[model samples]
Target: MPIPLPSLDDHDFDDLVGEARALLPVLLPEWTDHNPGDPGIVLVELLAWLTEMQLYQVDQLPQSHTLNFLRLLGGPQWSPPDTGGLDAAVRQSVAALHERHRAATADDYEYLVRTTWPEQPQAAGLPRVRRVRCVAGRNLAGTDPAAAAPAHVSVVVLPEPGGTADTHPLPTEALTTALREFLDPRRILTIRHHVVGPEYVDLVVSADLALYEDAVPTDALADARNRLREFYDPFAGGDTRDGWSFGQSVYLSEVYAVLEQSPLVDYIENVRLTRTGTDDGTDADGIALDAHQLVRLTRVDLVGYDSYGRTHPSTWELPA
Candidate 1:
């Protein structure tokens, strides 16, 4: 869509004349003959017409000013047209002004990533951005939270779920490289930006819960398991519904709270999180995540339990 030009002045001739007439009561109270035929009213109308013309010209900034704007933008491809007027040049300059080419703030990087790709359609059909999080001061390649990567900004991207992407939807190498190159010129001189795919820590949440007598054991258990999965969702998962925070640790208390919030579950017990492909359940308070790491659910286990020390399967259970 073409960017709309802002109107410099919206006042027309009648508006300007009416304004002047209204001012007469305050500025020149002695003048009572404020009719259309009055000489003063005619003078007011003439001046209003002249002012309206000037306002129209102001809306179209001088040709020289538009050319200067292009020059300030580093003069990418625009040049003064010999045959046609400077309308094309002016349009290009205004469009450039509206384009977000700055990378000073974290938000700028995220916005640029979302907008930069669609404009330059590639032949390989590169992966589209599903979501992105900008993390400042960390090298995602190493992914060490203790390591200080000064002057570095890592953008973690999750590719849209299509176009030959993996089941986890990571961006292809081509797309990553293209995005980095696209942002190089927009970044600050001293800053270096890295574009990389999101690193997700596969985890399984296993728990045993007690349900109210009126609660359906199977249905309640399934709801409790699903609640845990959605709490760490990549797109709509965080506590604020803005996706999970990168580098934010996951605590057992939070997991317990998620299941505890379920209306059917009366209480929760034995909530454990284990990294996928590992036998050791994390007994720590929470799982630590690096600056670029996000949480992904691999499995969920729920079993029925009672205060009387009885345990049985609720809905399903993963093989031990």
Candidate 2:
């Protein structure tokens, strides 16, 4: 359906007369002479006619005329960016006009991956970005940019955290495809990009917990569990809470300190930390992570042997 056009005049002579009559009671209560023969009434009529003339002139102008006036002031001819507000959209469009869309450096490729693919739910799943690292060409020793390989680039990406069962796997196929498609068009001709995930080292913790007299065993255990999870969590773990930085090492002393922080914890006993997957399971003070690798906490178990010679979950007791 066609929309109705707006009225040319927002206020007319009758509206101005009504406004003046309304203000008279408040502004000049003594002067109640509002007849057409009164001088005040005649002056009001003359002023209203001038105001109506000015409004009609303004209302008669076409939209194109207003735009042309804006053009004279060096304003944009087209609509501004879709930022929901005109002032903000104008600024955004001006900034966007000066922005570069092409990726030329390693940092540019890395920056594009983060800004282009925002962390949100997709057709596959939620895209949680952990880290992005890119390097142009494989030759680290080459100082000359002209001698570098034009068709080769190594890109490593770390994905969001996973459940305890999944063991925090690498970035999924969905994320890899998204990054590739986003950068492919902007990349130089014949440029090849390799997208891969970082390597992870799996770890397991074994510790004995003793509850104090004022501490509840269940509550302490829960806190202990959460502390370990937060310590190893890729999204919100480590000292900084920004997720452990790449190649950061895990120390057994830190784990002991975390568990001991619980008010219920009297003392930790038989505390042992071990690294799996890469070598024989052995006790270690800490696990060393490579530059491209992160540590993943696989399991945390507390147990004791029963009279039946079977191992079962248990918590140590504290004497009064």
Indicate which candidate wins on TM-score.
1
What is the per-residue lDDT of model 1 for residues 1-320, given as tens digits with 9 covering 90 to 100?
76799997899999999999999999999999999999999999999999999999889867688677777774666676565567766666677687887889898998888777667755148777878888888777565645889998988888776632234567878888988888888999999888888888888788888877777767787788777767887766879876787777888999888988988878888888888766774857878887678888777878866445556574433222
State the lDDT of candidate 2 residue by residue for 1-320, as single tens digits.
53675777799998998899899989999999999999999999999989998988876756566445544544566654455554555455556655557788887887777765573234246556667777567422245422566567756687765755554668787777777776788888877876767666777778877666665556667678778878787667888887766678888798888888877676777767677665545446677775556777767776433234344364422111
Error at 131, model 2, angstroms: 4.7
- Looking at candidate 2, the ten consecutive residues that score lowest on lDDT are 311-320
Judged by lDDT against the true structure, how good is candidate 1?
0.79
Q: Residue 88 in candidate 2 has what lDDT?
A: 58
Q: What lDDT, from 0 to 1, does candidate 2 have?
A: 0.69
